[model samples]
Target chain A: MSFLIGDGMTGGYGSADILHDCTIAVEKGEIAVIVGPNGAGKSTAMKAVFGMLPLRLGHVRLEGEDITALTPQARVAKGMAFVPQTQNVFTSLTVQENLEMGAYLRRDDIRGTMEQVFDLFPILGEKRRQPAGELSGGQRQQVAVGRALMTQPSVLMLDEPTAGVSPIVMDELFDRIIEVARTGIAILMVEQNARQALNIADRGYVLVQGENRYTDTGEALLANPDVRRSFLGG
Target chain B: MVDILNALVLFSNFVLIPGLAYGAQLALGALGVTLIYAVLRFSNFAHGDLMAFGTMATILVTWWFQSMGISFGVLPTALLALPFGIAIAAVMSLFMDRAVYSFYRKKRAAPVTFVIASVGVMFILNGVVRLIIGPDDQRFADGERFIVRARDFEAWSGLSEGLALRSTQAITLVVAILIVIALFWFLNRTRMGKAMRAYSDNEDLALLSGIDPARVVMVTWIIAAALATIAGVLYGLDKSFKPFTYFQLLLPIFAAAIVGGIGNPVGAIAGGFVIAFSEVTVTYAYKRFLGHLLPENLAPDGLVQLLSTDYKFAVSFVILVVVLLFRPTGLFRGKVI
Candidate 1:
């Protein structure tokens, strides 16, 4: 069974729907990537799943249990975390404090979780006392991801993690994401780099103007001539 | 030598001691204002009236305690009633947040809208305080008036001119120091304080981190209320409790907040002193003080007051304008956003 599901999301800021009956699922221990052109509502779909945007005609489920009405904080408590595309880190807080905030809903001792996050992103550990704002772009992204991971989320959603990083850093971020997936966390990420993102995705979704045009295994979508021509820059 | 002694005494009475006390008061008040601005992302123009309300509560409680025959000896009876004032003010703040401010917050209203709403709140609170207190000045400061009278200091030092340090003024300085130390510690050491800073730094990121915005707003109001009460009560104790006096103090407080770099606590404190000293020194008549140092014919005919005493608040206003014109961020370098 899929660990997280967004079934038939249809909503936007106002009257017009940015997402129209959109469905996306992330299985346990897999990287599910969503790629689309600008104005395609990729981020909107993520927000709907995270409960940041109102759902006009859809429901989201985690492990087959409906949680469409839960607030974002409630979603965090329910073992689901979302990292937005920009300004995702508390810039004034130290690296450690940023991670500590991620575990705000948890009452237990988070030392173990902190150590685990540090293990996953060693640069964060090295600069734990430094403010998150002082870090390089790639390192800040790592801090953002590490902050979300502190909740020990079953499904970790990232919105365009590599949107503003160098090519080498983007490759490094993808490697860390693959490593996170190895720890049995369902990873749902939206990306602008369609081809590279699909290459590492266990499942790839191609969206156009808020509707899913194709859904397939990563390799299958890469080989699809139409996807290659339109999205993959043939 | 005589003129220099007189100037020093004048400086001590009007500038050094009073400036510190007033700066401390403004600092505390501005700290709360900055917190709300930082966390809530708006300038609460109602902050002055809120301080008035807190002081009004303190005045009522002090009167109650005094009537009950409870006293703190040489110390002002108002200090003993401070906690009660703080509690009531906190509750009032919570109510304001829950009833008025929260609606705007939920609507995600523009900061300017909040500013206007705060102005409305200011009027409501002003009316409420006036209705209860009768708009009259209440002298709640009882017991010894001065720690050291000028005559006594002159007798001791044989300087012909001596400082008159009021008991309330001394208390104001000591209490202000303690409050500042305690506030800094809370903001730096406590989890909720850090959460506040985080929220101020980045609101969306804070929400994403599972920090409840409502709880943070509640906490901000509570702290602001407490700080406002303390500052207002102390100001009243040092001077006199007149509701309108607090309303006037708002301009200077805002000047301090802006000068200290809005949303920056340390900046607020610095800005407070800056405004205080500027007000004192600019309007201060230096003729007498300079007379003793200069030759007989060189003695100036003017009072040497740069501006009249009535326009002291104007001094702060001028400094604020200059700061804004030159460095809009503030002298202490605060966030412009």
Candidate 2:
């Protein structure tokens, strides 16, 4: 069994379903990437797994324990951290303050976790006192990811973490994400740069209109001629 | 030299001292307004009445204290009664939030809806304060009135004009400074305060981080109530307590908040002083002070005051309008209203 699973999920923002029987799962220390065309419900699948989307007809389980009814906040308490694609950082707050707020639920000392985040994103440490709003887009994304890591969550979820950054920053962020996964945390992220994302992904799911069209090992998915021709623009 | 010294004394006596005291009161009042705007994301029209309500509570307690022969000696007995007033105000604020504002908040109502709801609260609070305290002026200040008596100053300085500093004015400045310091410290250093700022900055992200919205809102109300109570008491001590005056004060208070940038605390303080000095300087009759400065022949006969004190609120209105027109985000780049 996967460490975390959103099995057969079906739901949407309202009556009209955005996700249909979508299944996404990630094992411990593995990176699972979700990618597809625009309006293909790729982000919806991630939201469903994170409990941000109300699942109408599916179950999510963490280590075989059902968590289908939990809220996003409650899921955070259960060791899941989500980095939103936009407005992810507290613009008015300093970078350090943003990290502190992420660890608000923890009673123990958060200094160590903050230090770890700084290690993961060293620029954040250098600009710790600067307000997150003052940073550039890529730096702001780093602050967002660093804030989520401060929670010391078992699973880290990102929604198109590299959506608007330059290609160089995107590669750097991907490298950082790989480093985070090496720390034995399950990483599930939606990516727009599908080729680069699959290059580092352990498993990849190709979503089409909220349904999984292809699920395979990252290397195998990259090599598949049909996936290359249709989705990867071969 | 004597003419210059007398003119300086006259300016300090009438304009500087009064402006400082008035500015301190407005700063405190505007701080409360700014905090609510920042965290709750609405302009609370009821804030002025809340101050009146808190002042009324303090006045009642002061009257009781006087009857019991309790006093602060050199300071007004109202100072001792302040905490009880603050507690009452805090409780009332929490109740108002829970009973009135929370419903709109739960509905995710628009900021305009919240503003209109606050107007309803303002009417209720205004009525309640008037009913309990009566519409008449209540002078609760009882202490050694003059920190620097005019006659004593004249004797000491040997000047035609004597600078008199009222104890209430001194206390107002002192207390206002202390409260501002404490508030800034709390906001910058404390954990709960950071949570409040984070919530104010980004509500969705704050929720995702597990910072409880209810707790932040409750704390914001409590702090705002405390500030309003303190400001009301100080202003009452400096002048006199009247429900109608406090109700009327809403204009200047809102003007101060808006002029300073609606949600910025530092801007509130700056805005308060700006409005105060502008009102005082514009309305002040420079007939006597000019006599000291200018040659006897050059000194004009008519009062040199540009505006009447009766139009003091208009100064704030003008400043508010000017600020909104030119820089809506305010002097400190606070959130635009």
Candidate 3:
């Protein structure tokens, strides 16, 4: 078993199973990208892992311990963090306050953790006093990530972190994600920009109809004809 | 220059002083409503009745204190009894939340569902308050009657128009300002308060950050209850406590909240003053106040009242309609709110 694993997961929001025997995993210091079409259950699988949606017939384990029954807030306390695709920041709060909220469960001083987050995204420090809502889209994304990093979690999940930003901003975010992974934190994210997402991904997952169609290295998936023709838009 | 000073004194006595006191009352009521809307995502139609219930509680304690010969010296004895009233109101709010609101919340019911439920609560609370205290007006204010008497003011200023300052009105203004400041400080500075703002801003994100929704809701209700009781007690001390009058206050309080931008606290205060000034200035028989400013030959003949005091409540309705027509999001544009 990898460090974080959603093994043989099968669930849907309603009665029918959207994720049919879907399995995804990531190790320490690895970046895993889930890429698929619009209705390919990319977000659903992530939600299932995060316990936002109850799984009917599956188990999710972190470090070989079952956590499928835990609620999202409980999961957060257990060193798991998820940043949603949209409305991810508390827009009314200052950038610094947003980061402080991320450390809600921590009993110890989080100043060191906050400084580390600021180091990863220095722009967040400059805009610390400004309300998150006033910041640009890319800058807001930085606030979101900075907030998540305040927890100093071992594993982080992101859903389409670069959904609406310009391409240059997207590349900058990907570079930061790479830096986060290099610090030995496992990264799992769903990506709308499949090509760019996979370019830096160590493990790439191609999901179709909520099931894993291709599970391989990013470079291997990029080189495969079937993956490029079908999902990758060859 | 003397005429100008007299005019200013008249305005202060009739409009500014009363408006500020009434504005503080309305502001507190609107704050309660706005907090409920922000955290629970409901209009809380029962808020006015809740105020009535809380004031009834305070009045009961004040009567008991009076019988025991206990007092707060020059201050109204009701001030000493306020905590009991706040506690009662807070418990009632918690009970209502658990028994009524939590069911619909768990069902993920529509906002309208909560509104209808609160209307039911409104009727129940109104009935309970009247049953306990009766519908007749009860004047619980005791101790010093006036901070500055009209005759004393007249002697001091040597002006024809006398400025009467009620102790209740003075206390209301000071207490309201302190409450507003403390509330803003809590919301902007404290961790729990910021968590509340964050939860109100985006619930899903707040939950993701490990902020418990249940705790937030509980805290919101408690704060709202405290505000309601204080506002009701102050207004009761300023005017008088009649269960029916409190039921009537619902319209104006809601108007204040909406006029200021429903979820914005600052807007609520601003809206309170707006509604208060409009109601007072419009309905007031301005003949005397204006006669002080105008030349004797130009003195008016009529009462010069824009609207009668009997239709003062309707003023809120009219303003509500105008505000809704012009700006649906409200004066502060609390669209996200």
- Give candidate 1's error at residue A52 in angstroms: 2.6
Model 1: residues >4 Å from true position, as ranges? B1-10
Q: Per-residue lDDT tens digits of candidate 2, residues B1-337?
A: 9999999999999999999999999999999999999999999999999999999999999999999999999999999999999999999999999889999999999999999999999999999998897899889999899999999999998888888999999999999999999999999999999999999999999999999999999999999999999999999999998988998888888888888888899989998888889889999999999999999999979999999989988898888889989988888777864
lDDT of 3 at B133: 85
Could you tell which candidate, 1 or 3, scores higher by lDDT? 3
Ranking by TM-score: 2, 3, 1
Candidate 2 C-alpha error for residue B66, in Å: 1.2
TM-score for candidate 2: 0.99
For candidate 2, the per-residue lDDT at A57 reads: 96
Minimum summed lDDT over a 10-residue window in model 2 chain B is located at: B328-337
The residue-by-residue lDDT of candidate 1 on B210-315, one tens digit each, is: 7887788888898899989998988998888888988888888888888988988899888878887888788878887777668889999999888998999888
Evaluating just chain A, the predictions reach TM-scores of 0.98, 0.98, 0.99
Query: Per-residue lDDT tens digits of candidate 3, residues B1-337?
Result: 7787888888888889999999999999999999898888889999999999999999999999999999999999999999999999999999999999999999999999999999999999989998898999999998899989989999998988789999999999999999999999999898889889888888889888989889999999999999999999999999999988888888899999999998888888888999999999888887887788899999899999999999999899999999999997788866443
User: Per-residue lDDT tens digits of candidate 1, residues A94-141?
Assistant: 998898888887789999999999988898999999999999999999
The better candidate by DockQ, 1 or 2, is 2
How close is chain B to the truth by TM-score, in each candidate? 0.97, 0.99, 0.98
RMSD of 1: 2.0
